[model samples]
Target: MLTAQDDLIGHQTPAPFATSGAGDARFTERYWYTAHPIDGSELLFDAGLGYYPNKDVMDAFAGLTIGRRQYNFRASRRLGGRPLETSVGPFRIEIVEGMKRHRLTLVENPSGISFSLEFEASFPSAQEKQNYRERDGLVEEDLARVSQFGRWRGWIVVDGRRFNVEPAMWWGQRDRSWGLRSEMRTDETRPPVATHRNFFWTWSMFQFETSALSIFLKERSPGKPHYLSGTEFKRESDGSVSHREVVAVEHRIDWANDPLGQTIANGDLTFQFDRGAPRQVKMHGLPTRFYLKAGMYGGLQGWTHGDDRGDYYAAHDVWNLDDPATREVARTLSDHVIKLESAGDVGFGISEYGVATGYPLYEGPQKFPAL
Candidate 1:
């Protein structure tokens, strides 16, 4: 269990100033950024990087989804340089104005996708409650996470074609998290553990005109209640900020089975805050953009690598969504950018759902509610 002191202990007054005290094989410092056009363009961009200390490696991925077609680029290399200076090969994430602003840039690579975008925070960063749990004699420490909504300014070039990004018309959200994840283990000889059976996870941040909402949930196994945490930030007319914790949540998942019989969720979610009226949000899962089979765009298979210097691999091609030959081998994780609606508000974010089974660390049939 985590207390208030636990949350305050390692927190720096202003974030992005230094890394956290995550000293383990699985310690990971990661960044996730997403941007979309406000003019009803059917294009979206998602980029992220993860730094693993024990492995001494850093990897990055960036993708663009235009209508039904998606282009992705991924790279991994030996970790070096200052932690605050996020750089891995052609991808660089710099904190231009500390925690309130950042710039993510991708230099032109052989794959031909590049971008130079700036993110200006709309409100002060909100921290999620600290999480501490122990399972099978292994203590899981998810120390701290900070999320913020902001506007993007810059341009993204796809295959040498340039598209301008205006701050007023481009909105996005970003979060920085440093913690110990179960999957960061380096030992391969250990048998599968019951604690690794099945998991359900969702992390979403919705950006609206005057406010932003974020929701996070994690369930370790089937038939277990989930651990939920979230925050809502509203900009006041006087240039002040008001925020609150989201207290209650309920999900109405429209489940569908893929050709492989794996369950997938496509539906609506509702959240209740501690002080405000409940808000209902609807999610429309894009049939063509499912992450289970996506290469580095969102898939789990192509994004990971061994700690050994020679074992790193990067994704180069988009997985054909319709081909069974490619889909079967690419299926592993669920990543979707669902269209969200609540009242008259409309936005987009990710619904990352996955159930890990039949691996060296997780095996066997796990039951979850079917739609």
Candidate 2:
């Protein structure tokens, strides 16, 4: 099938855009965005879109948090007709100006949450370290991603209440990645040997007035990393961008006494630069959180990413954030609003944290303090 993307000069293989060179069903592309207030507020929003070319499916989700309640909307449809189309149901993402500006909108629906916001980048996009992994000789993940810091200007209406979004008061981050991610795919065959049970990961990006910092780490055990990178992007006076290398990164988290011990109460992230003394940033957790499952990252109910829902399918629901039982099940691989402080300056960003069985970062007695 020929589509608009086929006309572009960017083709890895001698096939149309409707076809993926990789035969694996897990070949996918995704776009994600998040917006929150610079000043502490009970409002936050995030949305994501995923396209599974091999599976012939495309899905997208949007979520909004107000106080202790979170409203969610999800949609899935066949991946055809318009190969370059980024809209699913009522959601659409428009690239007004390549990497500089984007417009995201959610029309009125039964979910009672909709918005028309534009994201304008403050700094140019930076390439992140590759996320590649394999287990038992099977390529589990091979992806490349780029991240940017930006501001949002628009309005959001939730439950009939309208909240105006101003670029000066709101800030956000956007990332685009494409590759073979096993989390979005299912494995029907069991491995002959049991794989390791431990997994720990944390990704955070913070922006101050003049510079932004991003730190990413994945580990199977303490002091062992599958991938790690710390980068600092600075804006120069001549409209040029410069990069600062981070020699090392260290983190310590105080877990909250929750059901699964996955919630973080606070933490300290120290970045050791190549030329200067280490910079320490303190993180204070907020009351609100965004569950990744809502966007089909892990799984939502019986639905998983890349699943063939139908030619056209859509669903949505609301979750009560105040319920302990609900939060217990939804807290895994979640996003929490964090207040960052360092060198007398304060910033806000999201702390995306997840832990599996054998991570021992805070296993010692002294690290497990009373919440």
> Best by TM-score, which number?
2
Question: Candidate 2: which stretches are off by over 4 Å?
Answer: 184-196, 237-240, 259-261, 274-277, 364-371
| Candidate 2 lDDT by residue in tens digits, 39-76 | 77888898999998878899999989888788889999
Worst 10 residues of 2 by lDDT: 185-194
Q: List the residue pairs that clash in candidate 2.
A: none
Stretches > 4 Å off in candidate 1:
1-23, 80-84, 184-199, 219-224, 256-266, 286-306, 310-315, 329-335, 354-371
Task: Please report, in order, the local distance difference test score of every candidate based on alpha carbons.
Answer: 0.65, 0.78
Compared with the true structure, model 1 gives a TM-score of 0.76
lDDT of 1 by residue, 1-371 (tens): 12233344555534322333444666777788877776667667778887775666777878776665567787777644344446767889988897798999998888778999999997778888776667687786665788888889999998667889888888777888877754532122332312334455567777677777888776664323367789988789998889989887766566555554334346667778889688888877654343422323322442443243343455556555556655455443434556677788877665665444432212221332110
TM-score of 2: 0.91
lDDT of 2 at 362: 55
Candidate 1 clash pair list: none
Quality of model 1 by C-alpha lDDT: 0.65
